[model samples]
Target chain A: MRGVSLATPYLHIDLPQLRINVRRAADQAALVGVALRPHAKTHKSAEVARLQLAHGAVGLTVATVGEAEHFVRQGCRDVFIAFPVWVDEGRATRLRDLRDQADRLAIGVDSVESAGNAGRRLGHTGIEVLVEVDSGHHRTGVAPEQAGVVARAAQRAGLPVRGVFTFPGHGYGPGGSEAAAHDERTALETARDSIQQVGIEEPVLSGGSTPTLAASLTSRAATELRPGVYVFGDAQQWELGIFEPDDISLTVHATVVSHAGGRVVLDAGSKTLGADRAAYSSGYGRLLEHPEARIVTLSEHHAVVQMPGPRPALGSLVSVVPNHVCSAVNLADTFWVAEPGGLRAWPVGARGLHT
Target chain B: MRGVSLATPYLHIDLPQLRINVRRAADQAALVGVALRPHAKTHKSAEVARLQLAHGAVGLTVATVGEAEHFVRQGCRDVFIAFPVWVDEGRATRLRDLRDQADRLAIGVDSVESAGNAGRRLGHTGIEVLVEVDSGHHRTGVAPEQAGVVARAAQRAGLPVRGVFTFPGHGYGPGGSEAAAHDERTALETARDSIQQVGIEEPVLSGGSTPTLAASLTSRAATELRPGVYVFGDAQQWELGIFEPDDISLTVHATVVSHAGGRVVLDAGSKTLGADRAAYSSGYGRLLEHPEARIVTLSEHHAVVQMPGPRPALGSLVSVVPNHVCSAVNLADTFWVAEPGGLRAWPVGARGLHT
Candidate 1:
């Protein structure tokens, strides 16, 4: 909303609120005696990662080797590729380079063949491999009972098996975060048992998503938490009752372009706001100025807002909180950071780095 | 399907197929005696635009001012910004520059206020404005009868009202394209009569979408067709029975990362293969190799495929057709164009230019 002087449909961050979130997450993780490696995919800025590190975040968690390489170049010492990435010759070379650049680097592996493929190229590089366990979401990852088999396969491939991890994506829905957190701990504990039975000692049980972070810090079962969206509260977190509107640090600055047929059309649409409307999400996003407004339809560059009351006038600026902040951030090349003094642009580094 | 040597999660275009689709579209437009101004937002590649022009496309249609500037810089002389853009001081300056560079520049205006704003800034620059009429899709544009009122408003603001345009976006569903095309013609014809009532003779009746392209070729209604996704057939078009599987020219080169729970996981997920799923879309996307596979789930870097038969082995390559080609192309920086001899990289020149 403060980006009035700037153009419409630009991403901006409230630095003070971002810092508040960073400190809050680190303090909460420390209170429960669990390590915090915040996912860098949400902000995708080296500056934001620096703030997380300054607040006692252990390292960074990324989904792609390109993201890891980016942060490593930005001087991040420890990095983890949380997704079960398939390693081919090209990706192996990139991972090897990242391994050489960073102090500690790890990747997730869920299958024996992928473990073998990665171990053959990255085993000598001291890259630790974590077995991914399916908590409940069932998108990826091995079953809790199969963790031991994957760990043994990694060991046979001459790669070090670090621990087991699970993403409780189920927490993002209508089900309460407590239930998903319980399921996360259950799966991680079972996977730990399976890994220990396979002769792996003291496995690090990693689990956490933004929706489950508050309920995920069980010191007895979990060693680390990887919550991405807490730093920048999105529409999903607010609608799920996990965060307040004031906790949202990032927003898209859009303008009222059309006020026709008793509806308001904003300049921001799916391309600008990112086309990520979760089933549980209230709308495409939340209009900060008009909380009662619902974005019923989104074209490529037009957000048709259905307001409960009077809509804003044309040419006026408003802030929009995207449903999925990570996907939204990926659509922009750069974002403005609002400091105590003024705003400055920062590149969305590692954007379009899907590989 | 020929990006075998490249990495997974990269976009590749079959040049021969692209050329065939381009020629077919041009030929159809010619047979109907209508103008073809293919939307460049689908591919966003200068090479693709050049191919369309070579095949007799009148010009290019873009969605944003930044997209228009990108094409203008790439030597696309006649470009139309199809979205009803809100003109602020910053966008006005950019539009002014684009109007200066391009041979013919036009923008869509659905509201009288936005038309006045654009006309005040760009009137002297020789930019044309097209009044958008609601032709079934209630997203943007004015009602058919209100077209005259907005046309008179634009004329009063010192801007040339070039024509009336409508997007038959409703055609992109299972209701079938023929009915939507009928609605498009009816709306455009009514809008034409309204503009004529305002004393604007022979107003250009511009309308089209990929879903309605086949039925859109009526000499009595539309003057120009702006079908974007026809060049690179998407899963939505294929599911709606508008395009066949072989008509698809672009596909995502993804690799099997895991095979768990009777599902195969690919490295290309929502981040790589866009997150656009129409209600009528079959699934998240269609696999080129395994047409029976349905993309059940998508993580940041994982596309969980539920196949009826045996899944592809881990580390094997597969091609994926995204649900929306434009959104998918917006996610990649560059794509490999498979030629008769070899492949060449073409930058998605207008990537991330979502003003």
Candidate 2:
């Protein structure tokens, strides 16, 4: 594209590939009769959100209230904050305004104390609260049986107990998706049954991760799926066998600024490509054009790539598929979308919304 | 302090401590009879740059041309881009404009090919070009012996050969600073000889890294030092004995949103604290209040903290000193400076100047 030569480090998103990925994920969720509430935390672009919605996404899932606010302002009516938010007075005020703006809004609650805080602050506001149940990730969430306790606390505090959700984050590791999805199903099922036993029925169970999306089809209790990074396959997904190299929709276009010996330095570094590193990642990222090259080290503004035999000349542009595409996208201010003959710049709408 | 309840994952920089760190680095540079050119890549704030200049910084050192442009636009009279830049026609045109704006503007060129490119593009502009020599960090830079070859090439192409510069980046690892500084001296001295043998004399040899700045005093060849992280000490510096716990000026203020057993999940994550993991890091970062706490894992929006014995209550605030302060600062839009009355927000002026 014409814009490819404008800068050393720029994010490029293949519009066609991105659309295909979105359609495929939506189709996969449809096949299982589950609503596809694609996580907007990955792209953080309202444009990408619209694409997902057009591809049959029911609503959108977000990680923070800031993200929810961004999407809600962009005309997304239904939104869910997927994290166990600690809603203080300030957040409660924002939630109230968001509820007034959006048609439907939901938040996650894993503890009775936090649920009480949210309920007391948001009492009689009709804000939907989902009990987050720990499936296998052990990051945040209550035990499957403990979901009923949290839901009851929310109910007592006058907040509506809508459903339960779990993130099979352990699916990220090598070949861990199958078992994580199984744990996700069992946990969601137990959470749903426990809530039902406590007079809470018709709970909408939600579960899915990019790595375990295919396996989520087997989740009998989960009513919806929320996969974030499937929209833009990264080096982690490719290395983990979740996505093929051809499936990567986003890549950072970087210039080889320095060529010495077998190593080359790119203008892109941690600030541009993100510092997200996985245990299984080969390096910081993979050079798309030169498969044999590995970005061995990254400072704030320099990525040092080591090549096996033939290294690209200095000033040559190389596309890098980041190890984690979500964090990478969050770092950039704009994404260059491939168009007919040129690239169109789209602002990263929800960047730095870390509240 | 009131703002602590407003945002969960906000960056807090102690103004008093930051001033102290600036003064100390300047004093150290003065003691060693070297000009202090603090790297702006760490904070990316023009306000911070003014602080460094006030504390006797002769000029500013940047990692990219965009960073140089950002600071120059903010009235930085002198700037040096430390990375070996690949100046194509567009960048060269920008460089000429930058050269006109600043009293002195310099760029690094490590290879003859790159030197030729820069020389051809930037010839007759009186723009300074420093040959980058590799000390110990195998990331970038030419060998000490290759410095003359590149400098000669630049001279032959009508570009002024200023001197050689080396980054003691190998100083980052555990107990590597002293040796890396020693290597930096040897490399720069050898590079000086290599250039002088080819008729280049009185070369303004420059070298420094936060970890090796103290040891740079032993380097008789280094005429100036560029230490970026000395402005905001991090967990890596504390772990490496580069600074004490009291010296950490910047910290990520995060709230514990979930309490699950002994581990609590904070709203801060890789997006807030940065995912710069070191082999010597205790975890992702160190907590200022709870010294025994370790941020064990990070998703994009959640930091899982493993505490010993006691843990903070849910919704309580905690200060986290990141593993790498530079990367952490890059993620935030504003730095909340602690004042006598309250915290004041300062925009990160050049946060994403990665070009």
Residue B64 in model 1: lDDT: 86
lDDT of 2: 0.90
What Cα-based lDDT does every candidate model obtain?
A: 0.87, 0.90
| Model 1, span A160-255: residue lDDT tens | 888999999998887668888999989999999999998988888889999999888743367998999999998989899988999899999998
Q: Of the candidates shown, which would achieve the greatest TM-score relative to the real structure?
A: 2
> Stretches of candidate 2 above 4 Å error?
A1-4, B1-4
Tens digit of per-residue lDDT, candidate 1, span B174-212: 966888899999999899999999889989899999988
- CAPRI-style docking class of model 1 based on DockQ: medium
- Tell me the tens digit of each residue's lDDT in model 2 across A22-120: 999888778878899989999999999999888888899999999999999998999999999999888988999999999999999999998999988
Worst 10 residues of 1 chain B by lDDT: B1-10
Taking all chains together, the TM-score of candidate 1 against the true structure is 0.97
Q: Each candidate's TM vs. the true structure?
A: 0.97, 0.98
